[model samples]
Target chain A: MKRVLMRGNEAIAEAAIRSGLKCYFCYPITPQGELVEYMARELPKRGGVFLQAESEVAAINMVYGAAAAGVRTMTSSSSPGISLKQEGISYIAMARLPCVIVNMMRGGPGLGNIAPAQGDYFQATKGGGHGDYRLIVLAPSSVPEAAELVGLAFDLSDRYRVPAMILADGMIGQMMEPVALPEPVDPAEIPPRPWAVTGAKGRPKNVISSFDLEPEGLRRMNLVLQETYREIERNEVRWEEVETEDAELLLVAYGTMGRIAKTVVRLAREEGLPVGLLRPITLWPFPYGPIRALAERVKAVLTVELSAGQMWEDVRLAVEGRTETPFYGELGGVVPSPGRILEEVRRYVR
Target chain B: MSVELAIPRGYTRVFSRPAALSEAGFTYCPGCHHGIITRLVAEAIDELGILERTVGIAPVGCAVFLDRFFNCDFVQAAHGRACAVATGIKRARPDLVVFTYQGDGDLAAIGTAETVHAANRGENITVIFVNNGIYGMTGGEMAPTTLPGQRTVTTPRGREPRSHGYPLKISEMLAQLDGPAYITRQAVFDYPHIVKAKRAILKAFRNQLEGKGFSLVEILSTCPTNWRMSPVEAGRWVAEEVSRFYPLGDLKDTG
Candidate 1:
């Protein structure tokens, strides 16, 4: 497809439609409103269902329903709205249903500001809702990447029967960039979901449920989910490394903070500093292996984010005291300029 | 006296389990109305010949295990979210039949917003609202539909309107909306009421088949074990006491 300038939210919506999204349900929230509007206008024209639900709770449940019916479905929201969706997300996870969810993160603890933030790292990577379940969390750094990751999210979610999420921020959601959108996926080419509750015609009935009153049965189900997650961890860890060959200082970030760190890397390199960037694309099955390997050779790792060092905790776990791990973060939806981040890199780079 | 009669010639079977229902025994407590309601729904499905393409959304209450007793496909939704789930199913595959089986707490309390909005949107789906006055599976907790002075585990002091608030008549409230095509409050307290309740359930499914939009049948049922009463007493309570607060008749039918 030809490259076209599109807002991050519009690009994601277009990408999801191309990825064979048959049902899209959402409620309006800031920083992601354009995504909903795009789906409302474009999805129906392409023969898909677009429903603006009564609330975030209802929207996620609608996604649950559509996914259970063996269709590619999705829902998007900002922070507080995402919190309301946690319960339904947990249900979808337990049922082993495949669906895509996009969270254009804004400031939060309670109804936080509409500015872009990376505060939902813990909620996205870790199990936000109650249960021993994990979603395939993908972090995208730019408009094009955000659009591309939506397709990957759907594919991984369907392949594993596990829900996948696009963990972006308002910065990416609102920013406009030229993107060569992915080719539309043929709905007929999608894999069959035999377990989905389509109907009982010509076969035994299919039941999509998370309720197992028996303790032993529930335990076995959890074990199966754990095994699938382990397989995903083995095969799906993704990251991007920039000039890490002979660098002594490493900068680790993702999403909006990641793109900013890329700029910091360029400026630091010009100033005779050996600073490399390690950006994780998948936040759940985080790129712990590559970070651990690089930490052994580097003098220190500086973690940058838009929150109070949420992902920094994961970096520390990967480094495991093998090297010094410094952290720099800007909370409350503040986006630090590359000049400010380069100064932080100057302190750590030998 | 136990007597075994020989099979008479030309004797025809009149009633049996609905084909849409599985042969498995129900998990409901004795005299609980879920079994009867389930049978009615299954009969409706069978009568309409939609068993092959019908999808049922089971709620989180006693009917949580509803998948086991149904021959058709079933999706067990979270507590109070069946209506939203049903909307998803029906919207995604309009040719399929979708229905939600929800209890009072699931429908009138936690899921009030989902139920009301789905009905208000006039989503083409069938909703079986089983109002048993109290939460059965959760041990007789006070439901939104719990009558005043009705003693439940949460309302042991005899529900006072000042603190506990009044019973929520959801069917009437939903009937006031323009979305729902058919909204009715029925009862299964006696033989005649049971027959009428079956007809109401059948109509709800039929309305969905005719593409008339959202149809909900609120069947006033008995929860004997949770109500701390015998089967007969519980049925009597639903007929005499519960029926007074929640009138048993069609609130609206847009046919």
Candidate 2:
């Protein structure tokens, strides 16, 4: 293990390289452009492929091609760019290919702002692309978690034969923190993809696509995808429960908000307020079981986020009539500080 | 002893159930140019033995369900987004032949930014652009390729140059870039012109196979139903009037 100081975006890019990814295709967009630039420089140095695609649409399609070829490939972009990539993402999911995507989310609804925003909660966790498809969305609260999640994303994507996403925001991507890098995985040790389109040798042929128009065929495809999702939900719901042993107020947050909420929890504890934090690591296949348990004991559940009220809906669903959930958020690129959250906690607890 | 050669019975028999053609039985009217263009692209893929390795991206217009017509991997992109989707596929799998089938509206209007940038980047992919001057899928609206003085749904009384913009020259504009390996403008209104269009498409596909950069073939096609003209009149207009504004010839063939 090598400990080094790195930005969240750079750490994720380093993790992608260490995971034996051979292709990086992306177009420059704010908050995530640094990640693409890092790949453009590092991929070529390591004998991998790097391309600054024509647009977000092109970048995503390039990811589809690379993923179809069965090489570890990825793309990175901000919120607006991710919107441009929706069609390609749907096709990639439909094809059931293993690829990584990093969305360093920013404010949006149409070029809302460039700063970080958790507004993409519904888009990321609840299927941003069309049709009945879900990307395994990993929300990293810190730079180290961002790097760690990249490796996990690769593993999960390959194991499930589906696309996985590392959904961060501007804060995580822009913040600097210490990260201990894992030993690089050997490219040769990774299982070979027999179905990859690597020049089509004596084999019959390999086709990767998302078009099954026959009603029965499309229905069957959707069923298979749903089954895979169900399995994921059963096996991959991850979260961190901090100090829930004797707390009355439970805070639910993820990504950047989760990081801030941690600080708020510490401050509340110092001030003698009984507060606990539930930070979801996997946004999709969300860690609802633990949250539901916490909701039962807590007096009130406070959902903190950067968006107006995106993840609050998820929190409500998880608690579901068991508890009253009040949301606190800052809209349009305004991220709440720990001080502000602490005040809200004091009001809710009292 | 005598040697004998077996020939295929018909053109339809030559194709292997196009995976790109939708099951919806084509919403296009009789004598629509989309069917011809679809057949031409499918035939080229068949002849080149690239069906398994080909990925076709359908645009948002009438041919959005191109996945139904071609028996290869297919992706349906947003309006004017075929090029972007094709770029992703090609970049991910360099060995696979990726192409986009887009209409005038999808290519020229909403997707112009994507198209221009993809061409500029020289992504190793092919683009099959069907330019019918009018937005055929939508109700005969004026398109960027709409010729001067042409009557369209948006331009009811003969398009005025002072009000409506002049016809766009997509092939010539693309040819200006050194990155584009091939750029051609062909028509499919007649048999001879159809043959030329096929050749251009085959060349574009071959370029991608050879790792040559971006290649686009702008097919000046007819839209009799949308243009409110007889099939014969539409074909004649493409040859006599449309071709005068958007010339039917190869503008640049670097390969």
Candidate 3:
């Protein structure tokens, strides 16, 4: 283990290298460029492959290629660049190639500014790409969590043979923080992939493909993907529940907003307001069970976000008809401060 | 007495023997050039003995099922995205031979940016372009490679320069770049033309094997089904009308 003061983006690059991912392909985009730069410098030093592809479209396809070749690979970009990658991401998911994608999200719809925004919540958690595919989305609130989740992402991706996304906002990517890099996993010890395209000599040719035009064959493939997602929902639901006991108002948030909401929770506690925070780590297999449980104990569930009520929908679903759910959010890259959230908590508590 | 083994007619042992292609037969109309070009490329891959190490990207359009015929690692890319996908494969595993098979609409229209930049960056990959002057898979619509004054489903009254624009000379544009190691335009309409196309295809693949930069082979082909012409007439049209706009020859050869 090594301790280093690193920016969130650098931490992610370092963690990816430590996770035994040999290839990092990406195109430079705002806020997330540091991640690609770090990999470009560090990967070669560590005897890995790093390339600046022609565009986000190419970078993602490179990830698909490397993953199909049975090497751990990744690509990172901001919101607009990620939209360009959706096509490649769809193919990766359809092919069942295990790889990681990092979206250091910024405001969007189209080139909506470089400031941090959770506007990509739906794009990341729900399928951003076309088709009936879901990426295992993990949102990291802190630099350490961002670093730690890289390894976890590789594990989950390979285990399930599906793409995993590390959904971070600009704040998490741009902020500096202390992080202890996890111990390096031995690459030799990892299980061998029989499907890798490593020159099929003395064996049957290994084919990596996403097309099954036959209706029955396509249905079987879709069923396999669905079963894998169901397993993920059952086994990988994770969240942080803070001070839920005797709480009158429950706050649901994630990623950077959740971190800010935690501060509000602390302030509300000091003010004698009974409030709790539920931070969802896995945004896709969203920790709804814990949220619903918290909603049962509280009078109102306040869903706070940096986007215009994206995650609020999930909160409503979890607490459907069970309790009153209100949304408080800032749109177009405007992030709500802890004070604003604390005030909202006070109103909900009273 | 010693005897030499002879290969069967219309079959070459050097080619991968068409295992991945369906015996149920091709979906292409008679005289369609796509089936021939596909076979030629597949044969080249077999001759190079790189079937396992090859990753073929198939673009949206007529040849989307190229994966089904190549028997290699195949990925279907969005319309005009085969080049981008091929760039990805090449960058990820330089050891693997990555190639994209694309139609005129895919290569010259929506994917133009990707194709131009990939070549400009001197990406170590091969691009196999099939130019039939019209969108064959989409009801004979006019394409970026569609000739001036030519009529199609979209250009029923004939293509006008003021509205539809002149056909783009992609091979010439690509050949102008110093980054690309090889660029050639060939047609598969006649026996001699097929021989020329095979040589161009071989050179493009060889450049990648030699660690040379970008290479492109633009094949002037026929779309009998979409062009609403007989297979024989379509072949003749490729030789006459298409060749006049896309002249067949080596535009650049760094090697």
Question: Can you give the DockQ of every candidate in the order shown?
Answer: 0.88, 0.28, 0.42
Worst 10 residues of 3 chain B by lDDT: B15-24
Task: Report how far residue A174 has shifted in candidate 1, in Å.
Answer: 0.8
Candidate closer to the true structure by lDDT (higher is better), 1 or 3: 1
Model 2 lDDT tens row, B220-252 = 888888888898898898889888888778898
Quote the lDDT for B75 in model 3. 66
- What value does the lDDT take at residue B32 in candidate 1? 90
**Docking level of model 1:** high
Clash count of each predicted structure? 0, 22, 0
lDDT of 1 at B193: 89
Q: Write the per-residue lDDT of candidate 1 for residues B1-255, one digit (tens) a residue.
A: 223465579997666778898878899999898889999899989888999999999999989889999999999999999999999999889989999999999999999999999999999999999999889998899999999998999999888989999999999999999999999999887889889999999899888889999999999989999898999999899888999999989999998
Q: Model 1 over residues A1-350: C-alpha lDDT tens digits?
A: 68999999999999999999999999999999999999999999999999999999999999999999999999999999999999999999999999999999999779989998999999998989999999999999999999899999999999999999999999999999999999999888888999988889999999998889899999998998999999999999999999899899999999999999999989998998999999999998999999999999999999999999999999999999999999999989889999999889888875
C-alpha lDDT score of every prediction, in listed order: 0.94, 0.83, 0.85
TM-score of chain A of each: 0.99, 0.97, 0.98
Select the stronger candidate by lDDT from 2 and 3.
Answer: 3
Off by over 4 Å in 3: A189-191, B1-24
lDDT of 2 by residue, A85-173 (tens): 88878888888888999999998779888898888888888888888899999999999999999999998998888799999998999
| Model 1 misplacement above 4 A | B1-10
Sequence-dependent TM-score of model 2? 0.86
By lDDT, rank the candidates, best first: 1, 3, 2
Would you list the clashing residue pairs of candidate 3? Answer: none
True-structure lDDT of candidate 3: 0.85
